[model samples]
Target: MKRCLDEAVLQAYLDGELSGDAALETQAHLAACSQCAAALNAAEGEGAFLAAAFAPDDSVNVPTVQLRARIDAAVARLDAQPETNARPSGGWNFGALLASFTSLLTFTPQRAAGFAGMLSCVVLAALFFSIQKPSPAPNSPAQEEHMAFVTQPPAQPKDGSANVEVKDAPTAPTPEINRSGVPIQVAKFNRPHASKPRVKAAPVASSLAAPVASKAQPLPGEKDYEQAIASLSTAISHGGDAVLKPQVRAQYERNLAVLDKAIEETRLVARRNPKDKDAVDFLMSAYQSKIELLTTVADQAQVAALGR
Candidate 1:
């Protein structure tokens, strides 16, 4: 600007809010002054960025008809609510409020009806209080009798009904207590041949247990486990005896011995109890262990070859 452009005016111009002679003058100044032009360009860039950044994500949503009308109506209703916060410009105006209230009290049918309704409410409340009976005082005989009735057991009826037990009110039943302090059921005393409290039998353990876990059953392929172990062992030994490190070779031999022993023991178990799931599982595991040992040695041999 010939005169440095005010930031606010420059902002307004960038927003396309400035018009007429002012806009024309701003355009001319921007063209002549590189500094103002740079500022205007920066402002434009910032405005564009802000607009894009805060823009509503409308791509995924279906456009609603009359969106502006709905928004405007909501804003109008918000503005129309009566404000309770009176302006503090004149401070408190008690006298003015009192005068207004007095004016409202002038004789009118509406006021008369309101007064009648209020008087009716007062009368009803007074009548309710007046009709309520007072409870007996603590020391009174009636109060004592009420307390005794609750705390003391009912007196047995005289006459022929003396043999019959009676209760003034049917109180909640209390369970019968045995000598051990356990609550036993209170069976009907009137029932014939009622002697002992029936005891519930303990639950028995079921024979079923998930048919043994899937892994606990024999592995698939009748001879596959045997073939796999043999093949893996042949692969490991084919690399030659001295190829393995001393410690590694010892460990491998030891593992093989253990696997062999496990296999023999499992075979014996399986032969004795072919139908036993545990024995079958043990036999399968022994074969798998041998296979794993062979695979480990084969991998080590390959690693050694790569190192060479």
Candidate 2:
């Protein structure tokens, strides 16, 4: 009897879906595994809470007046249409109307303007058609010349004593350019020599190296400053007693000024030593305080909007 239980088996047991030996085995596994036991307990508790919350109520029955109205409207529409056993009609017939409108437009005082527009349109259409046309079958004269040069067999050493005989290959015909002016070429290659081995390119280095982990250091006495700023911002934004009460507003301003001085000192330290983490931490704290100040000002605007 295997004592180990998978997540599904454990869930089924919790759900009371397993039977006999399988159920017993799951129960035994749960007893041994603390994590599984805790999960099963949570599931059972959730099930009990749901059962209590959604126990059926027979007293509530909402009417469907809106649903009934929609159904009636749809039925009425279907009843009004004539019966059709033939194939459905295709697209709308507007060819004659379009031709008449085009003819009228061509004869007006706007004819020159129309002709310029038409010519521009024709040029644009030709340009787009040329771009989309399958690139004219590589028939450029330069490409053909390069291919011929590469395919021409290497000149053999002139020796009557050599066993192998070399023959000159036939030249390819030049490609003719179309009036639209597009070039095309055919690529050619000579028989590869067995004596010379082809060298393949080396594999490139990987770009996805493990990133250096950066640990953010907590600035000393900065948390208190942030909390003060956050509190003042929240109070001003919400239009609470802080704005209406002079004493509270004065205290908020004083705390902000003190934090500003501390920030300046931190900035000076940072300027002296650029890589100091503490100085960087203090600068970030200052930025957080400035954000809070802006947030407070925006909130005051919202309060004014409410008055209007």
Candidate 3:
């Protein structure tokens, strides 16, 4: 007997892909060969099972026309309705405000005159109140008495310095004519001598340079500096890239060491003489530089992380 047909030849024969003579030959071979016939039957059974499993159901019907009509009606109603360009209330819409202003501008001149007159009346009322002064209140008896005393002339001295009669000094005699025909008075009185006022001398620069108090006080924002230092230290410890390049780490360490030494020296000087403002300022500046360096390192670390 001939060898069993290839599974491909049998599948092609079942699918009607074989030529007429080849298909007839395959059918004869399958009828004479029980093994080939059983294989073909199994393939046919699998194909039918798959087809049945995936076939479309006849019971689940779709009403395409009705659904299409409903959708069309909804679309037609939407198209018929007018679209409104609504906006949120209380918003500053410049275009709308401008339109309103233009509408107002279209009014007749009489309305404009009325508006102007109303504005003028408001301005006039404001000016009247601003320019007017309150009426003065009547003075009390004591105030009147005080005013009278202040208006009274001062008493003349015994030396007759004023043009009033003095009790101890006699009045001037009638004027006599001099050789040049000018009238001259012949009375004389003793005048009191005025004393000079004593003046205080200005303070010397060396005396003004003396320290007023000795108790040491910290510089302004000292606590803020400490806080920044602590925060940056914590961030350096907990944050930044997991690993930094060796060279970068070395350079940052060197800078930190130099700043640390400088800060230490400044602290010593400030401790020796807490009143030394320059030393305190130097210490504060060193701290600020250290903070800046740490900040730079943190930034570089972030860059490195992002590159990664």
Candidate 4:
């Protein structure tokens, strides 16, 4: 008896479908060949996994009569096809048709349920994003009016300074009066007292002034958030008990949360590119957050114990 096993024979042995001499020969080959034995073992393991993963539920079993009826219907459909082809059709080649049908089978009720679940998840995600996203507020007439007012230039102040202009007020009308039966006209302009020569009021200095300090501008690429996070983490790790204040603890906790989120984002990037520096930077930040948390907690506990 030949001790060598062909692929089909090996498969049959794995399935326990072989019988008589062939089965005995396959068994002998499996016993003698470590490679064949390992292959068989692997095949059994895979089959067991599939069986457990895809086993039909007892609650959803098909009736024997229904199964038979389906088999009969399929047979009838096959018989109805013409035995000979009159000419080649452009619809689809046999292999392509089979592939398409196989693909369609992949979308069976179970698979279709899975696809529906996935679609529902996507829709829910989109809805959540839409709800969470910030949107532009609708323009209102009041808001428009307010905007117009805001956009208008400020009224110029009255002063004799370079940036200011002073305007004189209109003089009041003088009234005519009769005194001692004689009519007299009163002048509105008063002549300056000869004794005090008018020192033209030194042009009133401007009370309203422009800000002397200009706004500060950020430097180009000077501050990196990733490097900042990493530095924060290093500080937490090294500082240990030095950062024990409540305010410092709160700030550290907040930064830790940010670092955690950043690290998660970096991990997603790392999935695409293992060598991404951003991912590495985020990882370092995450490490720092952990260390900081531990150190802060330890310090806080020590402080509490000392008070007791």
Name the regions of candidate 2 deviating beyond 4 angstroms: 1-243
Supply the global lDDT for candidate 2: 0.63
Residues 1-308, model 4: lDDT tens digits: 44555667777887779888878877778888888888888888988988887777644766999889999999999999997654366664687678888998776788899989999999999999999999988653335435644675554434533442344455666666676666566767754543523334432233112211111221223135445546655554554645467787678678767756755544444433445565556555665565556555665656665665
The lowest-lDDT stretch of 10 consecutive residues in candidate 1 is 202-211
TM-score of each: 0.27, 0.21, 0.28, 0.21
Each prediction's whole-model lDDT (CA): 0.69, 0.63, 0.74, 0.61
List, residue by residue over 258-304, the lDDT tens digit for candidate 3: 99887765664564466778777888899899989988777766666
Query: Can you give the lDDT of residue 6 in candidate 1?
Result: 76
lDDT of 1 at 72: 88
Worst 10 residues of 2 by lDDT: 205-214
Q: How far is candidate 3 from the true structure (C-alpha RMSD, Å)?
A: 27.7
Per lDDT, the best of the predicted structures is 3
